[model samples]
Target chain A: MQRVSQRPTYKTIVSVAAAVAIVAVILALGAQKNFGPQQYGQLVVAGLGAGAIYALIALGFVMVYTVTGIINFAQGAFVMLGAMIAATIYGDASSGDAVGLVIAAIIAILATTLVGVAVERLTIFPARNADTLTLIIITVGVYIAIQGVGLVVWGTSAKAFPAFTTLDITDGTLRFWGIVLKTQTLWIWGTTALVLALLTLFLGRTLTGKALRACSVNKEAARLMGISPTRMSVFAFGLAAGMGALAGIVLAPATRPIYDMGLKLGLKGFVAAAMGGLVSSPAAVVGGLLLGLTENVAAGVTKSGLKDVFAFIVLIAVLLRKRGIFAAGTDLERP
Target chain B: MAADSYRSDTGTTTAPAGNGKESAPRRATMAGVVVLVALVLAIGLLEAFQPGGVDVSSLTGGVITFDTTVRIGILTIVVVGLNLLMGYAGQVSLGQAAFFGLGAYSSAIFTTRAELVGIGSGLEGRWWWPWLVMVLGMALTGALAYAVGRPILRLRGHYLAMATLGLGVMVTIMFRENLGLQLDTKDITGGSDGIPGIPRLRVGTFEIWPIERYYYLVWFLAIVGILLALNVVRSRSGRALRALHSSELAAETVGVDTARFKVRALVVSAMYASIAGSLFAHFRVAVSPTPFDFLASLELVVMAAVGGMASVWGAPFGVAAILAIRELVRTRLDLVIGGAGGEQEAVAFGVLLVLVMIFMPEGVVVRVKEVARRWSR
Candidate 1:
């Protein structure tokens, strides 16, 4: 114990050990549930796809919160803007091609990143001296503004992604030992994983990523070491917006991007961010996918239909637990 | 600037009762006189103009029919209560619509049921019973807010916002699903169709049916509400709220009971919403869950913030202005904007919110004050 206490980075090693054990348990239990090979396989693909989008938006939310010291209520609005612009540019109001969609989505992401920077630079920077409540009010005001803008541009009607054909060699079911996997779900799993793995690497190995993480943890020390927080904040916002645009694109097919989609998506992302303590990026990625799964699974089990009630139940449980809301003041006890 | 302590992370805080600080010799009559004059003008002008009716024809005409305006006016009062809670008090509550709905439904039931069960059988409750029901209903709702406030208020920022959002949604679901609360053995809430034919209000022999009459009544209520909110804002408790709004630590260190203040603010806001709802119940004679939702709550928040959160009188003006804008945007601009058939309003609302945040963060009140300052010279 004395030696352990004397060790410089003992807590860090312990954290890793705990993380591994918890992951191992979750995997073991996840494998034993209703999630058979087909379900498990589908969960991975679909989960990752959804997770990637959530990860990006969630990262943006956390990043903004890190520097501004408050949540950006407009983040989801930014996501919607990204998706809507992509949809519009990818095709005329009348129609579009495959390449057009891809190009438009990329442009939307890039453009929105600039928007992210501009918002932080102009709207947020001026009010850094304001109180938190004032800051919150400012953000809420921004949120309404974004919503209004969307309403003017897109109207209340829901927009649809271009039609697509499903390609499944197994024909909607991959039949191996009575387990069936859908092709679309399969794609989501792969894409999300690749992106998340890349993000993990970026945070661990890259200079920009390190700077962002460092700034998030300790802004003053980072500034002392010559990191331009303003630039980093903008960079973080850009990365998050780009990711949000991606999330919007991926999600559009499922929920169909509506003017109101941002509110719900933003709320869910906030939930996931809070659920993971807003400290762990990996946890957030997993947390978001799990939240989606939790809702769907709860709906399946209860049959009451998980629309409004499901979110409240999870939120209430998470909130009132003995360990502060989102595990505040309590260390994450790894299983 | 101490960057080390300047962490973005938020935590739950223990708020204390307000610091009782008086800035000026009590200009008590400035507020009182304003309410009295606004009331007399609102009522006297309507009667002088002879704005009367439930008639659809008059409503269709371009004239400012007294009835609809008054009903909307009353709704504004309820929203004012909501605004004070959200705007000045620094608490986000989405359950006002539910409280308003409940108040409207209960008040309707109180008066109508009294008329039905006791037709001079001595059990005939006082005509003012509806008023009682309104207060009781609002109080009960305020109690609900308090109950919801305790744990829910423990949430920080967005978490609180979403939780309040969840609360609003669940309450809507409850109103839709719960059978015991319905009227006449029908879904009586009429569910999606909404409850129409809400009985009109009566004050001593003055049969309040015309929107014009209700308009005066509502404005009267609104004036009262504004005054009440102003009192709350200027009160010792209001200061604590402002303190908590800035820094909970700073506020608590100064000996303010933050939790109690939050609860008080929430309850007071609910009461305001309840009063407004009661007026709405009598005026429109209709109430719907649809009108009171997350969007409604958001709109109220926007109204308060738009007018200026720090401004005492801005809440009422904000509600009045937003409603007027909605009417105008839908009516005056209908032809120009393809018969109001597009996402014009929503887009405008979003843009307005953004613009306010970006341009006038102090809200319209501050700008108005600035103009007044310049003009006074």
Candidate 2:
């Protein structure tokens, strides 16, 4: 009975500590001579934008883990591949303008979804019996394969077509106190919010969405219910991959996408997922955003080396704080 | 889907499967090891016999067998330790190389700074005393591993991998920062540029001369390491580890202290790596802090994975294979493929990783399995 009570007490302390920490951070940021209200606002917008990308990638990580009980390290590579394919489509002469870029985004999303489907069907499907680590190695193998192929098709030189400066209608910085806020930051926030609204709908209010959720919750039982977990895997991967691709296209104007961009981006995304206990799909998005804000703010306020250090610190804290962030079986309804 | 693929034109009237499908190709692994060893030895022998090239070795004469043998001995020991951790224990560790570099620096500091520290400053110091200090250095390094491995190894799967990887990165950063310890009075750890003048082991005027001697030295340690690993794996404790592969939860239910086993696995693996580090410091006669980062850890992971984990013989050969391929591409592939020649090797290895999946998913040893199956048939 004492042990039982202790568990909740442990949880309460952590939640309280987390709340205090966030309050302290915001208070501290507002208190800062350099980061006044306007700067904090801008930071939130930028953080949310970056966080959405991380959330999308985290979605794939959690979805795959739900069914397979293994983190697909290749998820990040998928994000990278999705972005690259999208960039390639847009690079072509047929799609060069704003309208064309939008079309290219759709084409790229479609192409990337197919790639995810192919990856599931061709590689991971056959190795069901292999150890979890072997599966990871296979994904790492997938990562290496994608890198080579991506590099071969597109050279090592970084590509940033359709620059990161679109939709800058605000076109000026918002100043209040000593803080500074960029117009693009606001644009990114608005765009991310719009995309997220659509995602929440598709996931919470649709039949196909329910099917995908069911598969992640329990592959075998979901199959018994005629959900074809394998097919769900394809679509789950597609949706997540598509989300990541959209992020890549959106952020392309901020920081250009490159072949190797996925690895680092993927790391941050996984951290975000883990941060949220891979719970409450929206938590992933919030976790990603929070992580981005924390890191960026930390970097701004302190030394840059802390960025990497900050990730592990958060990982250990959250991992210790929560149980089953990647708790399997959330994708499907409870039996 | 393929289960019903064999429904032929006879309306799927199949003969009841005779005595069920025989077990997977387990017997093939034994023969595969033999052939693979022979192939490796043949290649080694050929290379040893036909070698004529300008050596950029920093040593005087730059062709001593002792120094050359040292390099081989060092890498073998390090990779062997790695095999114990990743291959036997089923832990994906990329920190082996980092631990290795730490051991080297630890030992290197001990030997190079004895006089400055005012402990014993004369010819009375035995020639092999440097090695003795090196052992102490390794113990210290192993102690560090022990502290870190216990709590961190508790993390399941990739979380543990990332944590350990973080430790490696942290150590690498610290190693580079040139944080030196003042031993008694002298400066140890060589700071940034690293310790420059490490004396070579000499036998009077007749030094252990030539690169061939180093080859012999490496092979000797390699044999010892193989025997040690073989003995441990065959022991009762080894069975406990192998059992984890079968069913972790079930193994725990059966009275195996799973966490203790994991920690033990990590410590044992750390000791091997520490020994490797000591050998490297004494042999190379110089220690630097650049090559022991996360990438090296990844390369080590690649070695164990590509070789098919849980094999003692495969780990060393895997190392040799990766290094050889790297060296081969750097020197030879340049003429065949244009550009700086550096990127091609990584590209090729990446491609090889993918091909390993699609083809011999079990790796190159598949041929041996096939031969054994034919015998059985």
Candidate 3:
């Protein structure tokens, strides 16, 4: 028992050592003579905003995976749907139309939630007993179907929506110490913090949230305790869909929402979740922020076309280093 | 020999009882051969009978034609490898297209961009250079698969899928960025432009041109792939894969070396994809990153799923069925609906995959065969 307990400590030490080594390398690169401090600051700001969005979507992945034991590939599609639906609703709104933007966000979130529920009922619920690989493939199918729907609904053109603020292109933008920032970035950061806080509170205080947690911990026990696992799983999907939509709606102002944007965004978030070992919410948030920062820094150093290349490289490196990525704290003993 | 025990362990239970209750692997291989011959004949007859552009005015303007059959043939070769990995080894990989792209780009680079990389002023003009490049491409991709499959195969289910997805995306980014590999003037992979004007493959005395002749070549290779896969499914390795698929622990207990079998399946599948990709490069006389993206990977999985994951003989049927439906939707459904855009085929495939997985996980091949046998009785 002592040796078994000590093994994970040794492994944890190695994991931390490897992570620190990577960070040291990144820091060394940043300290180069040609790399300006201001540029590094800019990268950090952009990374924070990007990481917030990733954390929101990663929360969706963790929520669904914990409750239903399935990785919802359509999670990214939900993000696209939110952005596109909101854009369609708030099309060409005037500068002062913040109320309209709010309404559109509400509608988009609700609509995406409905789609998530429909996916669970239509595709996932039917093949609930199938193997894990089959379920993942099914989600991939759902993702494709939703992308097709996005193409049909919005056509191939990209769409842009008004941000939550009245921040204009010039006067409303903030300039602090030669660094330019947008009001939308503030909104993104605030919304992410608000979601995380609310989620933490809900899970801690609310009976329904606790039931969902219980479902994640043990489905049969929850069922025996008179909570319907079906309802919890459905609720989990709905919650995840709402989070994904929120991320999309917030992100659309920063970058125009296109029909196929979900693929990359979803993949990034999944990578973040995997970094958390696919189970921990706080860890996923940290993972998202770290990924966003590292990718931004790497992109700043290299070409921007390889910005995403950094994220995948991190994923592979982390996956290789951590043999317990799929085992530790993921309820692996359930099966 | 242990194929029956493997099949039974997997709970397929759909294998029919023969007149003499003959061995399952032999029976399955014989069926595969029959299907291969029938497919060849059917494709031949279609090529001979289908109205060409000169015969029918409507057909002249359409994009889907006998060339689509050739595309299906090429894709059939790739999907056979996917079927073996997913069906027999019970491992899920979404990076098959990455291997395919690697093969195509390797062939393209060796044959066309050799001079750009300073490998060949004379080798590029050789008659057998492309063939050598193709073989080298297969070997490289197989080695890559072995390296990647080692650690990733340890992760079960969706984690493995996500890791492979990351791999696929990385491959695309590398191709898109050209890996910073530059010839004094331009990027090596040609970036989005890819490597165009790859020299067409040649036989001893003749260049393989004309769509019909290339179609035969591709189908011939695809048939060979099918036979090779059937042999693998009938061999001891096949049973070991099936055993791992059913229960890795049980297989391990029986001294099956589950990890080695898995890596073997992945290497075989990767080689199969690489060969198909080499054919694709030669046939198109060009190579690009566009066709081998994440979507292509998903489409390959869809082909495997729609055909039947656990059956080796389902690859061609899956390719033909999915492509035909896609062609129909792309050409005809747009005309009927009038406003659905060009993504209807993707939508149909998505729906088909879901429905098949939910209701008919055995896929079209196994289910149809079972029905036919029962009806004959």
- Candidate 2 chain B lDDT trough over 10 residues, lowest sum: B4-13
Q: Which of the two candidates, 2 or 3, achieves a greater lDDT against the reference?
A: 3
Q: Per-residue lDDT for B78-182 in model 2, tens only?
A: 666666676556666756777887777766666676655455755324676655666776677778878877777666556666567666766665565544231
DockQ for each candidate?
0.23, 0.15, 0.51
Tens-digit lDDT string for candidate 1 (B1-377): 11111111001122223344632313333654476567557545645655664333244454334444564566666666765566555666645676666676666555554444233423224556667678777878888888988887766555566567777766776555532242455454455556666556677667775555665667777777766676666668767877776666688999999888887887887787777777777776776667676677677767766666555456556665776666656656767765564356665665566567556666776677667769999
- Write one digit per residue (lDDT tens) for candidate 3, span B1-377: 12221142112244433346676656656776787778677656666666452422135355457778788899999999998898889888998999999999999998877876678578888889889999999999999999989988877677778788989988988898887443437668989889898888888769887777887899889888988887787678987888888888899999999989999999999999999999999988898898999999998988887788876667877888887788778777867898655677777788888888787776777778768779999
Q: Candidate 3: deviation at residue A302, Å? A: 2.0
| RMSD vs true structure, all candidates | 7.9, 8.6, 3.6
Find the candidate with the highest lDDT and give its number. 3
How many Å off is the CA of B169 in candidate 3? Answer: 0.8
| lDDT (0 to 1) per candidate | 0.62, 0.61, 0.82
Q: Which stretches of candidate 2 lie over 4 Å from their true place?
A: A1-11, A14-50, A82-97, A161-174, A299-302, A320-335, B1-75, B104-133, B169-211, B277-290, B325-340, B355-363, B366-370, B373-377
Estimate candidate 2's alpha-carbon lDDT, on a 0 to 1 scale: 0.61
Q: What proportion of the real contacts between chains A and B does each prediction keep?
A: 0.39, 0.16, 0.56
Give the per-residue lDDT of model 2 (tens digit) for A198-309: 7678767998877776776777788898888767766666666666666666666566667777766777777787776664566676777777877666544544444555
Candidate 3 lDDT at A79 equals: 97
Clash count, predicted structure 1: 23
Ten contiguous residues with the weakest lDDT in model 3 chain B: B1-10
